[model samples]
Target: MSKYGLGSPLKVVKKPGETLTLSCRGSGSSFGCCSMHWIRQQAGKPLVWMGCVNSDSSGNDYSESFKSRTEIIRDNSKSMVYLKLSGLTAEDSAVYYCARNSL
Candidate 1:
């Protein structure tokens, strides 16, 4: 079990050329002080670090492969983080995860 509980949908379906938005809601006192990371793992494949956004909305960074197609947003007031991916394709399918980390 995790000290800070994070909630997200079990699955999402989208078609090619469509956009997808995934939400991650976290609960804990320290949630607002940490950065949120979005990662994905395909079947039998290694985890891929997609991107991250600061809780304070100070900044964000994305992996080279996802830089142009992904966006991460954090809303501390709602204790939620979001991952938006555009120009989707079959190759974008994967199991996504959201993790919190202290600065």
Candidate 2:
């Protein structure tokens, strides 16, 4: 078993044609304005920016490839963001990181 269960218990659920909500918590203080960015990494390679959500009010900003496929919404009161991927596939498998970008 792995410490973070990456290899042992890979908690991946295939949503297929349905929309799946992936929740993430930011690695920043809750009191300040920390914009969250979603990044994707495949096979220990360099990470690619998928989208970002402002913790204050504005909704989200996504890359061109994610225009109609991905969404990053949040419940700021809970300090949590929900990432919904409309379509799922084997190629979508990667390590997603939720980072905070402060201005």
The top-ranked prediction according to lDDT is: 1
lDDT measured at residue 45 in model 1 versus the true structure, 0 to 100: 97
TM-score, each model? 0.89, 0.75
- Runs in model 1 deviating more than 4 A are 1-9
Clashes per candidate, residues 3 or more apart or on different chains: 0, 0
Residue 101 miss distance in model 1 (angstroms): 1.2
Q: What lDDT tens digits, residue by residue, belong to model 1 across residues 4-103? A: 3445447778999999998888876778987889888898899888988876989999999999999999889888898999999998889888887744
lDDT agreement with native, every candidate: 0.84, 0.66
CA lDDT, candidate 1, residue 5 = 43
> For model 2, how does the per-residue alpha-carbon lDDT over 1-103 read when each residue is reduced to its tens digit?
0111112223556756776666764433551376667777778688888887776757689999877999887666767776777887777778766666645
Cα-lDDT of candidate 1: 0.84
